[model samples]
Target chain A: MTKMTMVEALNLAMRQEMEKDDRVIILGEDVGVDGGVFRVTDSLISTFGEQRVVDTPLAESGIIGTSIGMAVYGLRPVCEIQFSGFSYYIFHQLEAHAARLRHRSQGRFHVPLVVRTPCGGGVRALEHHSESREAYYAHTPGVKMVIPSGPRNARALLVSAIRDPDPVVFFEPKALYRAFREEVPEEEESMPLGQPQLVREGDDVTIISYGAMMVPVLEAADSLKEKDGIVAEIIDLLTISPLDDTLIASSVQKTGRAVVVHEAPRSFGPGAELVARLVEKSFYYLEAPVKRVTGYDIVYPLFAREKAYMPDTGKIVQAVKETLEV
Target chain B: MPRSEIELPYRIEYLSILDENGNLDKELEPDIPDDILVKLHREMLSGRRFDERMLNLQRQGRIGTFPPIKGQEASQLGAVATLKNSDWMVPAFREALAEFWRGKPRENFILFYGGYDEGGAVEEGRNDLPVAIPVGSQMLHAVGIGMGIQYRRKDDVVMTFFGDGATSEGDFHEALNFAGVFQAPVIFICQNNQWAISVPRSRQTHAKTLAQKALAHGLPGIQVDGNDVLAVYAAAREAVERARTGKGPTLIECFTYRMSLHTTADDPKKYRSEDEVKEWEKRDPIPRFQAYLTQKGLLTDEVVEQLEADIAQEIQGAIDRAEKLMAREVDPLDMFNHTFAELPPSLILQRQEAELDLSLRKEEDRHD
Candidate 1:
């Protein structure tokens, strides 16, 4: 096992997949010789050549539209949107064509494509670069949304996404890209999408979250255990769209209380869907109602107030306490 | 000093072989085999019959909606005739005739028009894209496919069909620009059928010709008399040859007219005058080609009659087959299945909810 960052894990997955399948190609703005804006695709251009790892002109719609054609023509394309906010420009191609091609084609054509973009706030980046809009994609049918919390999960989930027979939107939490490192297996291994991983086990209230928010949730769990003698179960719902309700239900059943957390706005966010599912499936097992600790429903604030805008250990611990009290 | 008024440089080439009276210009006649000529005429006539039958089917509410190619048969037949089975074709909405030439099943179009499914069947390796209705969107697909072929080291060329109105779209320019930079093997065939819905050709662009628009993209541009079957065929053949030999993409603009409404639902009378339609009718390609064939002693009156009967029967058989086909029940889970290769947990729950909703509806219906 070799220790790597989330970015390195992603790069390795892409390299391995491209080597395994000639049909697999990558396209995005600044993905070629420049690597990626965050260096996630560093050294890819030299390894695969420019034809396989393409640096397309800065047109989001053009990138996605062309990928559709390539996919239809028997090529597997993995496109990178420089930032999650920029991905909005190609929603017509993503929602209208990429998502519906198979069902509309009556299973005649399958779009084996992956669109990877860095999402979430707390990176102190410019406006439009920091936004968690996984809910928007999850709401739209015909796209699978995957958000990996750590290096090992990122490598496994991305490989699975690349080989999947349908279009996938892989959201890499920007804040976690270099914040943490872990030993990832050198050999190729894949984890099935739509399945949640139990990061830490405990008998007390469960701390359910994903993406960058996983860091704060884990820290909050530690705080609760060390200070208050509360052993919190931390569950990372890696794949957001096809949520692992079975895993969530089982955890909530054991703990008897749940606190969903995320960096996206509180109202109608990804966490809302999680809470709704928990309520419906594990309602009888719950000792208290599911509570969400999330960002406020407003535009991501300036750097001055960035700390307050994002979920933190304090907010998550408070939520856990509130849920436990009720 | 007064502001300088700079002149924009432009070059346009016109290719033709048929005169206005439907007589073959002796100097430019193609020495085609008799069997090939017969096949061309047969396909053109069949396309016309199919267009008419589809229009009737739409009116009878047997099919959904249709984009008819009533007057553009020769333009479509001529351009598509030059394509080998290995070459690729990307079509805009109005290229139903071209779709037929590309071997797209008539039943697929019928099912698409009937709103039963998204017209999906393009025989693998036949290199045909499904009908793109978003105006000029298919141009990009054509360029991308050409790029893919180039990467694979294949000698295949791609022919993309669009319209006069598509020239105004940014995608058209982007596609052309990419093709130029990559020196991709592609032939951009623009069927200038005059009107885009209610908008006229003049409104689409201020340029003297759509073909000349290709100059900015660093490619040769040629215009041909679309109603003259031989002229359209010759121009397309030249362009295809150029692309196949690695000379890069060419833009061939076929000057044609739209003889019918945009589709079965459109009212052309709201936009154009009867006199304009009458003027274009004088140059109708079907009768013109028929006259030329008769003059050459290649097509007897008996042969024409038999050809018409044969095409009519073939169309009727297609209609019967489409009608007899069983409609598949809509699967709600299908909506979730293709979105990702693996089902996400949230989607699985949503699918369960949808199934529960369907069961509830069935239970209510039983009570009613």
Candidate 2:
């Protein structure tokens, strides 16, 4: 066991998978000599050789489109889009081809591909570099979308994504890449996708959040327990698509109150869907209306307004307290 | 303006094996067997007949909207007819003729357009891709497959077909560049059929020729007379051989024309002139090949009659096989099947909800 950042965990997951499966390959800009823009694929080329770790041209459309082809041709190509903000250029290939291959082929073929990209804003990168657009991929029915809040789970879910028989969009929260470290075991742990993890247990109110937002939600949980004696149940909604309604509903049903938190815009974001599922399944059990603390519905703005737009611990605690009061 | 740069790039040669009057150029002609030429003619004629019948199928409300493959058969069939059994074929929407030549049953197209789930499956055991609708996307996939072959050190080559308008897409250059840099075993064949849904070739790009676009990516590019089947076959065969030998990719620009509307729903008269249509009619692929076969004494009146009857019989059999698939009879739930290898829990829940909704609708219909 060793302490590893999300970046190291990601590299380890791919390295392990590639070591196990000869078909696994990494293709992306600067993935070879530079080890990717965020070093998520550090030293992969030297370890696996250039044949397995390919540094591609600065073309998102080609990276995704060709990866789809490779996936169809029986290669498990884990493509790095570098940034989720730039993934829009390959949306046509993703939605029209990669996502639909299985259904279109009537089970004859599948796109066993993993698209990993840095997602959301906190580090305040330049234009078209930071975005929380997991909603877009999650909305795409065939693409299983997974975002990691911490290092260990990131490695586990990535291993699951690589071996899965369909396309997966893996978003590693850029803010959480190097935020902290945890003991990630060398042995691969395969966490089935579409399942949320109950990070903390409580009976008062369930705080549902995932990815970087888990940080502030946990902080709010700590503060609420200390000052107000409000033991908030915290659930990390790891898999954005195919959400774990069973886990979410059971937690909210027990608590009888819910607060959804995310850094994405409040409108139609994953928080909206989580709240909807809660209302549908845990409606009768709910004691108070479910609340959401999220970013404002606006393009991720510059650094000054960035933090203002994102929900913080104070805002989350305020929402949780409001729900608890009702 | 910035100071002039060095010489831009090398311009490759254009190849034409048959004259406009269907006279073969002895020096440039490829030595294909006589029986293969006859088979080529029969397939080309059947493809034209199929195109004509498909239009009738759409108008008769038997099938949905379609893209006609008229005037582009030489570029499509000639290229596909050269494929080895292990080679892969990546095609676009206007590739039914090529698909047909490569063993895709007519019902495959019929069921695909009729909206059946199984229609998109490439014929069992075949390496051909499904009909991709997104323009210019398959080019990149072909490069990837080629790269995979190179990595595995396989002798098999990848063949991808696109159109003139696709050259303007960014993926076109990216695919070509990657194919060049990686020395991937891939053959790129573009059916530069004069019009992309009424946008003339002149409007698509300022470059003198679409073949020249490959030069910037450091690949060989050749322009061939697309209506001359012999020329198209020679160019495709050469390119396929080059790729198989690990010489990397080659781009073949088949200079042809789209004689019909882009699709059954389109009206080419809205953008193109009658004079241009009449001029391209002289270069129609079927007639040009028929003329050469006639001059070779291989196409007599009796032989022509027998060929037409055989193709007509084959087409009737295909139609009979396709008549079983009905648009309104398909199950709505079939949409969720094969979405994943095993239905994930979320989709299982969604599918259950959809079933419940359908039952409710049926109950309401019973009341009505």
Candidate 3:
């Protein structure tokens, strides 16, 4: 076991997977000599040679579309879309081809491809770099969507994504890349794609969130306990599309009050889907209507306004207070 | 050494031999055995008859929708003739002729047209992909499969069929670009059938010809007279041979015309004049090929009658088989299935809800 940040864990997973399989290749902008702008692919090009670790021309569609071709041809391609916002250009290929190829071919072909992008708003990044639009992918059928909240899950889920016989969109929270360290197993240990993790146990209220929002949710839980004597249960929804609703419902039933959080706009956000599911399954157990703390439904603002745009500990605590009052 | 910066343009060619009178011009005859020529003519005739049956079925509401390939029979059959059973085929919507040659049962096509699975005719590892409907999506798959075959060091080649309208899509450009750079053993066969729904060939492109577009990708592009069966076969054969020998990819543009509406739902008369139809009718490939066979003393009236009778019986049998098969109850959860190897919890819950709804319906029926 080793203590590492989410970014470091991801880099280690890539290195480990590459060492195990020669068919694996990584391609993206700034992924090679620059070690990726986020350094998620640092030292990979040097260790694995340029052919396997390619720094491609700055074309998102080309990167993704060509990776599909490569994946079809037998290479397990791991493509990096510089940021989540830049991934929109390749959605046509992702939806029309990558997602449909296996079923269209009636299981004759499998695209064991993983597309990784840094998602969520925090750290005051530039425009288009801080948006969490993973809900769009979670809504798309045929592709698996996984968002790991910390280093340990990041390393495990990425390896699973690479080895899975389907296309997976692995969203790494940019804010949590270096947020904390945890002991990731040296041996290959993978978490299944569609399971949620119960991050903390409490009996009063359940706080369901994933990715960057996990930070504030935990912080809010700490504040609630220290100040208001409220024990807040936290559930990290690891996979958004193949949502671990079973775990969510169980957690909601235990707590009786649920608050869903994310760094995407409020309307039609992933949190909306979670809230709807909670209402459908645990409506009788709830003490209050489900609440959501999410980004505003507007264009991701400039850096200065990002703090206001994202959910924070104060907002989460307030939602908890309201739930307790109800 | 620094690479030189220079701009170069490539030219594409469209080839044909059948004259407007449906007579083969003597100069462009292929030197193949008489048996092969007869087989080619039979395939083209079968395609024409099958297409005519489908159009009628659609009109009678027996089939949901269909994209007819009436005037384009010669181009589709000729191009497919150059391929072996082991070679791969990627098709756009209007390649029913190619699908027939690929041994797709007529019933499967009817099932697909009757609002069954989108891939009713798709048989995996059988050298053909399902009909791609999003215009130009399959071209990339063709390139990718070709790359895979090359990586495995297989001798097989992949042929992708598209139309002139597909040239405008980004996937088409990206497929061609990747095929060029990777030197993949793939052939891009574009059947320029002169209309994408109501859009004319002129509206789709302005490069004087569609074949010339291949030059930009560093591949040879040839244009064949789509009405001339011999010309299409020869061009496709040459391209396939080049690919098999590791010479890289080729783009063949078969300039053809859609003699019928885009599909049964479309009304060509709304946009096109009858005069244009009459012009193409004069160059109908079936009669032209029949005339060639007769001039060569390879086809007789008795043989033609027997061929028609045999094909009509086969097509009717397929239709009967498709209609007789019990229709499975359409499961709502089937939409969730095949999305992934395992159902996600959210979809599993959605499926359970649907099951609950079905049980409620059953109880209501019992009470009624």
Candidate 4:
């Protein structure tokens, strides 16, 4: 085991996969010589050379669209969009071709492609760099949407995403890129996509979150235990789209209260889907209405108001307290 | 120092073999075998017949809306003829004739138009992508396939078809640029069929020729008489050879006409003049190709009559088979089947709900 940041872990995952399988190819803007903007793919071009570690032209749609073709043509292409904001250019390709290819072909062709993009707000970045729009990909049916919280699981989930037979939109929370380190295994390790990891086990309240939001959720859980004498169960939702309803429903059923935390906006977001599922599955066991601690409905503010926009440990603790009271 | 002008020495070539009046430029005619030449003519005629039948079916409210491939048979068939069975054909929506020639079952097209997901299913081992409906999307797929071929060290090239309007799309430029950079073995055949629904080719772009757009992407480009089968076939063959020899991609612009409505649902009278349509009618691909075949003693009046009769029968048989297959009630469960290789727990539950809902409906129907 080695203690590494999320970026290193992700790099190790790609390196391991590419070393193991010649079919795996990495392509994106500056993914080659410059490694990546975040250096997640640092020094990969030297190891795999330019063919496997490709530096593509600055076209997001072309990157993903070509990846789709390569996937269909029997090459496992992991394409990187510079940022999640730039991903909008590839949305039509993702939605129209990537998502529909398997369904449209009716099992004749399947796209086993992975699109990795950095998301979430923190560290005072540019306008489009910080927003979490995972709901866009999660809403897409054929495509799998996964967001890893930390280094250890990021490595594991990325391996799984690469191996997944269908298209996977793997969102790496930029905020967590170097925020912390975890002891990732040297040998191969993978966590299944649809299963949420129960990070903390408690009886009072369940806190469900993913990606960078897990930081605040964990903080809130600790502070709640120390200050308010309330125990909280933490579920890091690795995969957003599949939304491990079994885990969420069972946890919510046990606690009878829940707070769903995410950095995405409140309106028509993944939180709504989680709340709806909680209502449908564990309504009889509920002691309180499920509260969502998420970004506001308005646009993700610039740096001046960015901290205010994101859900913090304080807000999360408060939401948990409110849910407990109800 | 005085500034000197820098000139890029490049000229886009144009190709024409068979003329409008059933005349062939003898020197430029392709050296195709007699048997393959007969097969090409048959496929072209079959495509025309299929289009006519599909139009009739649409008028009778039997099939859903689809684009008609009229007046562009040579552009579709001729280019496809150059491709080997191992080579990939990534196509935009208007390549039904090409798809048919590439061993895709005729029933698939009928079933697709008849609104069945089963329609999209190509048989195993066919190197053809399902028709991409969005304009210019399949070009990237072709390049990617070419990249994969290069990666695998395979000799198979890819042939992708799009329209003149597709040249304006960012994907087209990106695909071309990538193809050039990677030196991917891809043949990009642009079927410049003179119209994109209500808009004509003039409004689509200001470039003198769509073929010239390839110059910006660092690839060879040529304009061919799209209605001339011999010209399209010759150009595609050259492009295919260039790609197969690892010389990278080439862009072949087949300049043709969309001699029918853009789709069965469209009204050409609103956008185009009758004079333009009549002028193109004189250059119909089928007759010109037939004339060339007749000159070679490969086709006579009796042979033409018999071929038409046989094609009519074949088309009718295909329609009958498709109608019979679709007559059976499709399982609603099939809708949730293909989205993933293994159904997730969430989808599994949804599938159960759907099953229960369907059963309840059956019960309600029984009570009624």
Q: What share of the true interface contacts does each candidate keep?
A: 0.00, 0.01, 0.00, 0.00
True contacts kept of 2: 0.01
Choose 2 or 3, whichever is better by lDDT: 2
Per-candidate local distance difference test: 0.83, 0.83, 0.82, 0.87
Per residue, candidate 2 scores C-alpha lDDT tens digits across A1-326 of: 99999999999999999989999999876577667767889889889998998866445787889999999999999999777887887899999999999999999889999999999887744434567988999999899999989999999999999999999999989999999999999987889998998999999999999999999999999989998999988889789998878988888889999999898866789988988887788789999999877765555553423555566777787789889888
- DockQ category of candidate 3: incorrect
How close to the true structure is residue A301 of candidate 4, measured as C-alpha lDDT? 47
- Computed on C-alphas against the true complex, the DockQ of each candidate is 0.02, 0.02, 0.02, 0.02
The model with the greater TM-score, 2 or 3, is 2
Residue-by-residue lDDT tens digits, candidate 1, A1-326 = 99999999999999999999999999986676557767788888899998998876545777788999899889999999878987886788999999999999999998889999999877654446678888889888889999999999999999999999988999999898999899999999999999988999999898889998988898898889998999998889899887768888899999999999988876799888888888788889999988877765555643324564566677687778888898
TM-score to native of every candidate shown: 0.55, 0.57, 0.56, 0.58
lDDT of 4 by residue, B133-215 (tens): 65676799999999999999999999999998677668899999999999999999999998766556875677899999888
Task: Report how far residue B91 has shifted in candidate 2, in Å.
Answer: 0.8
Q: Could you tell me which 10 consecutive residues in candidate 3 chain A have the lowest summed lDDT?
A: A300-309
lDDT of 4 by residue, A1-326 (tens): 89999999999999999999999999986677667767888899999998999876545777898999999999999999878987887999899998899889999999999999999988554346678999999999898999999999999999999999999999999999999999999999998988888999999999999999999899889989998999999998899987779988899999999999998977688999999999998999999889888775554544434554567777787789988887
The 10-residue segment with the lowest total lDDT in model 4 chain A: A296-305
For model 3 the local lDDT of residue B225 reads 89
- TM (chain A) per model: 0.98, 0.98, 0.97, 0.99
Query: Interface RMSD value for candidate 4, one decimal?
Result: 18.9
Weakest 10 consecutive residues of candidate 2 chain B by summed lDDT: B325-334
Measured by TM-score, the strongest candidate is 4
Model 4 clash pairs are none
